[model samples]
Target: MSNIIANQLDLFGAEEQSELFDEDAPTVYYHGDPDRVHARLHRLIAEARGAETLPWDQDSTRLYRKIVPQMVLWLPEEEAAQLRFEFEAELERMKAA
Candidate 1:
């Protein structure tokens, strides 16, 4: 598991660049127990607002990757798509730059 996390961190790839978001959006509803996912999402959102890199490996990198996709299930479909698209686009831009 630790080895997997290290690999994920290596591929997380956004570490060297920061992407800026023009709007502040509340995290869509997440129906889960109070845990790291909730906190991490909030942190991610805040980072997005500040144009910072959103790190992976919360609890574990694999777990962090898993939680992000699951979170979309609780959001309105359009909002979920928009966020996903924007984030991916930024990551792509970062990778390119």
Candidate 2:
């Protein structure tokens, strides 16, 4: 039965998604409180407070995005997208100010 076949396909064990990743891959992440990044950015921008060279420069912006994701064997896409949007909104507020 199709139901039986589908049930059999479920490994349903620890790290069942391990096949999706290569452990040796290089990646970046923010292991600390994600909100801290936004707070820090706001502080930095506030300190600079209208400088020509803002703290969140091109490389810094890249690092922001760079800090957002990782080579984890698993992360729900919706969770990642939510995190991405949170950071993007933080940056947008910085830019708007």
Stretches of candidate 1 exceeding 4 Å from the true structure: 1-66
- Whole-model lDDT, model 2: 0.55
Separately for all candidates shown, the number of backbone clashes (residues 3 or more apart, or on different chains) is 0, 0
Best by TM-score: 1
The superposed Cα distance between candidate 2 and the true structure at residue 97, in angstroms, equals 0.2
Q: Write the per-residue lDDT of candidate 2 for residues 28-96, one digit (tens) a residue.
A: 664555355445544544544554444566997677556555411134566556555655666676667
Show the colliding residue pairs in model 2: none
Q: After superposition, how far is residue 47 of candidate 2 from its true place, in Å?
A: 13
The predictions' CA RMSDs to the true structure, in order, are 21.1, 14.1
- The alpha-carbon lDDT assigned to residue 53 of candidate 1 equals 46
Ten contiguous residues minimizing lDDT sum, candidate 1: 16-25
